[model samples]
Target: MQTGGHIAGWRHARAADNALCDAEYFQALGRTAEKGLFDGVFLADYVGYHPVKGAAVFAGLETPKLDPLVVLATIAAATRNIGLIGTASTTYSHPYDVARRFASLDHVSGGRAGWNIVTSTMENEAHNYGFEAHLAHADRYARADEFVAVARKLWDSWQAGAVVADKVSGAYTDPARISAVDHQGEHFRVAGPLTVPRTPQGHPVLVQAGASATGQQFAAANAEVIFTSHPTIFTAQAFRADMHTQLAQFSRSPESLKIMPAVTPVIGRTRSEAEDLKRELDDLIPARIAISKLEGLLGNVDLSGADPDGPLPALPAEALAGENSTRDRVLELSEREMLPIAELARRVAAGRTGHTIVGTAEDIAETLIEWENCGAADGFVISAPFLPGGLEDFVDMVVPILQERGHFRREYEGTTLRENLGLAVPPNGFDADPTSRRRPEIW
Candidate 1:
């Protein structure tokens, strides 16, 4: 069972007054996750801001803050055991740069690094990247497919035993053991081996966060860890089943992938206290802000014309075909529950529409165990609704319960991220038989 800690929770109203830019805050959070024996601490990144939401949206959030990789590098120095996974966009970055950055991180962290591959969907992100608009969903994924292929080839360019630093003979590296990738893809072209040698784990574990059909297929082919959000157990189960089927088509074992859904747990010593905390946070969020947030999750659908007290307006077909999976889940829930627009917004604000659990430590533990045992998820990415406080609460309260129940590890299982996650090291391209290579299926 793997668990990852998310630091973006400080964006909540309850945490609005906190100093989100403080490096000490994140360092402490990483330590807390390490103390709990978590598999990783994931740092989410966004290149653009939500202008529609106005200045209030930027006020409490870390949206315009430090780069994720920079922060993860700092966290790497502060903690010894926890994996540091940073988000990067294949849509915006060159594959060579991405490969080199992550490879360097892996070496610096002693193989405790992971790359959360993302095809940035925000239009503002495109503007920042010198594009008039975001790439179409399919086009973005296509580029990402080629980008990953190039990166993998670069990572595998050097043989494991290539580095032989000898003092007597004055030979630093065996030239015969390294070769140029010479990869020419539709989206990327690389001429030579990566500057750095193979990392401690051969390659940093690949993590992905896309829930669309295309996203799942990409993940099944390449990702060792998948982070997603599902509002219901049934939805999660269906997603896992679909991923399993996709994996079989690629001749990959289901065990190679770990599906971790985002779960926000509001915990307390008793259920009543937890409920009160949840209510406090819910009440703090302004209606306009909540609606704006909900709008953003729904692919920036205009909710201004929506009657606050009435049911959601008929969604356009084009909106339904967009890349946001959260929008689809929200629409499904709203229809199923016959919810008013305001009610749906409120539920989403309260985290109710996003697999949130409000309960005591034991209650949260039981829910997690149930999800894991029922195959709804391999584990969870704990999205604390508030920083230090919420993270501290889980680490001190919920983690102990999970450990006592034997549902989680009590100590660090391994040094590398892949090792702790039970993932196999990728074979060097030069050493592997061509027939044994699992080539990703391009859509």
Candidate 2:
């Protein structure tokens, strides 16, 4: 997330002001993440921000969005060990294009590439793709289901060792090591092999971002890593358990999928100091921006004239009827706490849906460890509340504590991201190895 994941993060005095256009800024952040021995640096870009009814208030979120693939490639060139995970909406893209991009990225990054797959949810995304409207959630996932299937076929077309340069025999390639996918599915009809060779990690790691029931099913069948959000340890634990059960249904082991929850850490030298920092950041939020953010989240209900200090007004039927779990949770929070419009907006702006850890470095470390020990997360996807500084703090301060406690690595575990993450390279699809660890059900 460029400036930071927090919507108002860019306004913070300490946040990087030029990150939107500054390649060097991102490169620096990648290096910092690498220094912490993070499994990957996740870049969240919107093909279109998910918008709902009255979403025009957000102008359909036609904001300048980065192409994560382009940015990840830059980071790939700069950083050697950290994984490069880029967001691409299967809803708005073709399976062949996405498959080839990540495969090339994996090869370029020395097997440190990952694809964060999303079935985009936005009207603008639909328009950009030359459609009149967004596909329904079920339809989107259905398409994504077929999209990934075809992509794997393309990736698998070129078997491992497909290239054999026998100079004397004048054989530069092995015809036996390659095959055409010739796939025909409900959403896609892809023929033959990907232009790129099989990547160093077999195929770049597949990461899925969606927590809905249907989304979870897709992740179980297709994704090797999942990016999820839950506000509490219990919620996260419940989610992890549910996913484990789902994985079994696909003939996958508990270790096959890594569940990574988004976490934002607000650290300070002392507990009181941390609380103060959180307050300071919250205070920095401009009321209009906060309310606009809330409006966007809740189907863009018009809060223009609503009193920021007043309680949340009765939401329209459409807002309440939508299946957005995040919106529902926000509503529940307001009713449960009787929080005023502005307060809730600010709260939402600061953390969105992810859990926030506010404390000293030790406190942050302990919270993370507790969550891991309690089966709440396979790992965490830390969203630095602000860039460079927030990330640097975690790397410099919190990382040492984790390393000392033996919860985190002192150095990366291996050269390739697959090795460091402890994932096996999926066997080439052309020739299936029943015993060989493969991407979940890729065959």
Q: TM-scores of the models, in the given order?
A: 0.92, 0.92
Candidate 2 wrongly placed segments (more than 4 Å): 49-64, 167-170, 335-338, 433-443
The residue-level lDDT of candidate 2 at 388 comes to 75
What digit string (tens of lDDT, one per residue) describes model 2 on residues 1-443?
Answer: 77776665666677777556668987988899998999989987766665433555454222356788888888988898999999988888889999999989988899999999998756777887799987887888889988888888788877788788899999876766666777778888776667887778887888998877888899999999999987789989999999999999999997889999999999899999989988888877766667777887786688877888999999988767635656766786788678999999887888887888999999999999999999999999999888778899999999999999989988888988888888888876557743322232223
Q: What is the lDDT of candidate 2?
A: 0.82
Q: How many clashing pairs does model 1 include?
A: 0
**Each candidate's lDDT (Cα)?**
0.81, 0.82
* Candidate 1 worst ten-residue window by lDDT: 1-10
lDDT of 1 by residue, 307-404 (tens): 89999998877678766666777888899989898878877766635588999999999999999888999989888877767877889899988888
- Positional deviation of residue 299's Cα in model 2 after best superposition, in angstroms: 2.4
